[model samples]
Structures are given as structure tokens and as C-alpha cells.
Target: MATKVKRARKANFSDRECVKLLDIVDANIGKLTNNNNTLRANAGKKAVWKMAAQELSAMSLVQRDEEDCRKKWRVSSLIGPTVTL
Candidate 1:
């Protein structure tokens, strides 16, 4: 019997990659950060995130998925107040 170890993927975002992500999120700002609580707005936000992830991965050296993009956005939100966008 053999035991296998799971490997962790590298998740460091380069400065250029972060800029690309910011650009994508900026392009979809309304849908991504809207405060409206309606179902249509919620669904649109999801679609926008998916599209953002696709766009980011297409241009980025690191292939980021939808969840990855979402996580990065959430992390970036902590500095939202300071950043002028």
C-alpha cells in the first residue's frame, strides 16, 4: 500500500497579473459590486464574475478560475477604500 500526498498549487499573483485582474473587475464594476438585492442583479453578478475569470485567465500567466477571481476580489476589497481605481 502506498500513501499519496496532495500538492498545493502556487497562488502568488504578479503585479502585472493583479493589474489585469483589476482591469477586468473595473470593466464589470457595476455588476460585480452593485448593492441591489434583486435576483436579476445577483445572477448578473455571477455571470460577470465568470466572464472576468475567463478574461483574466486568457491574458494572465497564471490560469485563474472563477473561484480564484472571486477570492482575489474579496481580498482586494479590504483595500477598496484606499484605492482610487
Candidate 2:
């Protein structure tokens, strides 16, 4: 018998949550925005993201992990704010 695989729950960030996440990211921009390919730089980026997740979880009702925060940041940056004419 094959075991069923469980999928992770989706994260929906509110406007306030998004603002908080951006604030955290901005504070750690030096570490998070580095483009170095070295292992140390990659580790630093990971640490920063993890810290951001913790900060978000503490400030809000929703609990977010490092991967969740990372994915949300990517999607947010890509789509950005939409303006309707």
C-alpha cells in the first residue's frame, strides 16, 4: 500500500503582514540582497530569511517558516502592486 503525501498549507499574507515582512527584509537587506555564490554568503542569506520568519510569526497571528517567507517574498516582488485605471 502506498502512503498518501500531505501538502503544506498555503500562506495568505495581509497588507499589514506584507508591510512587516518588507520591513524585516529591508533591515536585513545587506545580508539578504547579497549576490555572492559562496557557501558562506548563501548561509548568511538563509539565516536572515529565518530571522525574518521568526519576526513575522511573533508579530502576527499567522505562523510562517523560512520557506514560506521566502516564497512569499519572491511572489510579492514579482507581481508587485497593481494599479487600476
Backbone Cα, N, C clashes tallied per candidate: 0, 0
Best by TM-score: 2
Q: Taking the tens digit of each residue's C-alpha lDDT, what string does model 1 give over 1-85? A: 8999999786676666677778878788888778997999989988877887787777766777778878877888776622343
Position 17, candidate 2: lDDT: 71
lDDT of 2 at 31: 86
Q: Which residue window of length 10 is worst by lDDT in model 2?
A: 76-85
Which candidate number has the best lDDT?
Answer: 2
Candidate 2 global TM-score: 0.76
Model 2 clash count equals 0
Q: Candidate 2 on 1-85: residue-level lDDT in tens?
A: 9999999765577777788778888788888888897999999999988888898898788888999889888887899832222
Give residue 75's lDDT in candidate 1 (0 to 100). Answer: 88
Worst window of 10 by summed lDDT in candidate 1: 76-85
TM values, all candidates: 0.72, 0.76
